[model samples]
Target chain A: MGQEILAIIVIMTAVTYGARVLPFLLFRNKRISGVLKSFIELVPVALLAALVIPELILTPTNEFTFINPFLLTGICTFIFARRVSNLFLVVLFGMVVYWGFDKII
Target chain B: MRVKGFIYGLRQSVTIGIGYAPVALTFGILSLKSGLNILETGLMSMLVFAGASQFITIQLIGQGATIWVIGITTLIVNLRHILMSFSMIRFFPGISLGKLSLLAQGITDETFVLNSKLLEEIPTPEERSNVALGVNIGAFVSWVFFSFLGAWFGNRLNINFSGFDFALLALFIVLTIGTVNRQNITTYIIAGLLAVIFKIIIPGKIYLLLSVALAAAIGAFLQQKQLKQNKCQGENS
Candidate 1:
């Protein structure tokens, strides 16, 4: 890689690492308030929603749902994953459903 | 009895490693198609280590976007790390700043989930940190390795990666379902709808942060309301 690409990677790493480390550093020894804890507790679900909803449905950019059987794909994946016990198997089932739906549509 | 936290962490994180493989392979293939060399692809996986941000970065780079665009956008997209790390503060008490920083580098979504769930199970701080390091290293190696594999053989391979995209959605579904106990179904429903609405309206990575903030506020509000009601019942009694 050239200096430019290396520089971009470095900058990306720096900012990401800085963000990840900031909370642990700044909030050291401080009491986390109840409201703050509640909010933080809620974050994973909210962020996951923020990510999945957009991508699964009408995404802003280059959405595969355009040509693909978008809703059916999601439904089938959801149902198919439920029957599987293993995480890997669930994901594999979802992918299979995705491909099957894509072909049908 | 033998206690091996690092080995335990590795065993626990093997699932995470497997989960990351398909997506990371797709990332490698995408990066290569986006005109990145094998070195650049591997560097992005090793350094950035963020799934969504790296994907967006590749798309932007392919579009001849500026460094500022990629940098700022990826940083914003990954802002939720602040919340995740904040939640982990009480779990990692009394650790040195340097070690904390090192552990923070290894925290991905999978590791964060694993560490939070297993923190209470592992009593000793030393063991806990060791396991966390194991999870981090395991996932990191898996990601970088698949990325290199994809980049090296991208053009020579004839694979349809469209199905691979479902892995991301499947991950979110599993995570969300894991949280869908009787306690907070309403929160999930409202937050989920709000996220969709927020995305449709805003149509950028910033919407992700906005939606999370708003939905988390809903949770906070519900908690406050319940607390106030408890106080009222106490006063009446």
Candidate 2:
């Protein structure tokens, strides 16, 4: 049992680390081109959106309602992040909004 | 300066770590109740530090999923790190592969935002790398520590941080704010729509990959056309 668990851990570590490190290794010494640079800049924004929307907030039972706590929190974060420019406050606002919703609804 | 950079990095990482602590504790408790011992739970936390995948792994383990499926699922989830790492390369000066390997292991979605902003604001390479080192190491330590705490204590440690899970999403939301300029607004919106569409259609980690691919391709094409137009305008002038 211990051996099996150890094997699983090893495989998990290898794959996770590989995914993280492979891109850096591949582009280690190369001069990134103009097109590649433009594309790379967009990667974070595009990917971050993909991770958040639909995945984080699901419309439960085929209805258009914010089933996830993320809706209010996300809006709060978006507003505070622009206004305050403080991550700590943004998180606090998001948490309060989420906790408040959980209690109320 | 290096020391200062590391200290700053550590401090900022702690800020990010604050958000991760609850989630880590939750995972630990969940894994413990799911039949993992403290040691196994801690090892999973150490080896697979990625959050989403770790959560899925614990869930699948509870259901008696096979090792291959668990492993593949995790890899698929984390494959975004590859895109993230590629994006980060523009900010770094060429360093040796040995050091690069160590640094790359530390890249997470949150830290990518922090690091990208750090590079944009500061021109010092030495300080940037040093701070990044501190941030990653600090986040790594706290994450592992909280996991162990959760495993030993289990669900009894719950303080009802239901929405704290959104901290990462909030951070990502903040991180993505400034990237949308006039030129790229349409492309970003299109990409977001595509991501939603793909999520509805194929429905899995593939949406992450597909949306990122399609968005980048479309954005780059638009960028190319803009560049060519500017050149033609310059020629005509």
The per-model lDDT (C-alpha) reads 0.74, 0.77
C-alpha DockQ of every model: 0.53, 0.62
For model 2, the docking class works out as medium
Q: Candidate 1: where are CA atoms >4 Å away?
A: A59-85, B1-3, B33-35, B113-128, B161-163
Superposed model 2: Cα runs more than 4 Å off = A55-57, A60-63, A66-69
Error of 2 at A9 (Å): 1.1
Summing lDDT over every window of 10 consecutive residues in candidate 1 chain A, give the lowest-scoring window.
A59-68
State the lDDT of candidate 2 residue by residue for B56-137, as single tens digits: 8888888988889888988888887888888877766766677677788788877876777666776765667787788788
| Model 2 chain B: worst 10 consecutive residues (lDDT sum) | B154-163
How big an interface RMSD has model 2? 2.0
Clashes of 2: 0
Model 1 per-residue lDDT tens digits across residues B1-237: 124777777776666776688778888899989888999999899888888899898898889888888889878877867777887776666777887888888777667765666665777666777777777888888999998988888557666656665765665565566655555565666677787776666755667667777887897789778988999999999
> Which pairs of residues collide in candidate 1?
none
